[model samples]
Target: MGAEVLADKVYCYPFQKVVTGYLNKYPTPLEKNVTAVTTVEEQTDPATGIVYRRRIATCNNIIPSFLRKSREWIFKWSILKVTNIYLEEESWLDMKARVMNLKCRCLTWAQYASMNEESVYRESKHNSNWTEFSQKGTITITGAGYLNCILERFAQTFLKQGARKSIAIMEKILEEKYGSPVS
Candidate 1:
């Protein structure tokens, strides 16, 4: 089975400020779950001037108690590969990230479960002083095993809660950094 979550918000800050804040958001108080971020690759298109960056972020897993029994077999460290592309001319940024269990062999059972998230930030079409941000996320769990099905149900709830909490934190941080968003 699979579940999808979407969120949209606007910031009162200009596109440039919003984008800069996003890049520096990890070290903020809002993202306590994130432990470390490492730049795995980065490059710039000399002709188009588009910037591309890839990073690996490590976060703590907040698995439910029932799932805690298999925590070791589930996930030791949640590692996500985040890719970002910035269109300087258009004042647009697109980011996509994915989490897979293959990186941690101990979490073999979680191989069937994967999560993907995509977000886009751009200058508002109506106002240059505003920035529009939208995010879409999907979680997929598929396996014929009975254990997998049980885990999927728990995972769905876990992911939904995590997404909401993360969004709230992000909005709070943005408000603090750029002031209240334009209604």
Candidate 2:
């Protein structure tokens, strides 16, 4: 019914540079599945000095090929019938704290299945010049018979690949912006 995915990484760059790279690396060719990203809401809290952003990322439908043929099952469950999948994301940035946190949730198949992801980037405890990144996600699938387990496994595998791709993109972004690796 559910599965958890966790990932961690360390970037040999300052927190600011790492966070900047993450913010700018999205919607790139590495994430071809992602079609578009739109900011829905943005605000700066004067009291806390935290910047908040809400974005919606539209992605190509990646439903398992096996499920693609089960049109009746999909239609009966009233899942996402469209070709595009939408993911809602919210991010909080604390410049003074040199930290950023992001949360993402799937919107297209919320009823039948859900994928929620959370990520954090902050100055490393050991070195201010380095950034530590941690990410975790939970995938829950319901309404499907035996396929729920299959879908969960597929989601876990897909998410691992996504993490690797994102890291590569982040590295490319940082190198392009900062000339070379910091450490």
Instruction: Give the Cα lDDT of each candidate.
Output: 0.55, 0.85
TM-score of each: 0.69, 0.93
List model 1 lDDT by residue over 1-183, tens digit each: 666667677767677666766666664566666666556666666765556666665565555445545344444443211122111111223322211111111122345566666667777877877777776666666543455566656666766676677667766777887787765
Candidate with best lDDT: 2
Q: What does each candidate score in C-alpha RMSD?
A: 8.2, 1.6
Candidate 1 TM-score over all chains jointly = 0.69
For model 2, how does the per-residue alpha-carbon lDDT over 13-121 read when each residue is reduced to its tens digit? 9998887777767688767898888989999999999999999999998876656664676447546456899999999999999899999999987888889999999
Q: In each prediction, how many residue pairs overlap at the backbone (N, C-alpha, C within less than 3 A)?
A: 0, 0
* Model 2 misplacement above 4 A: 74-81
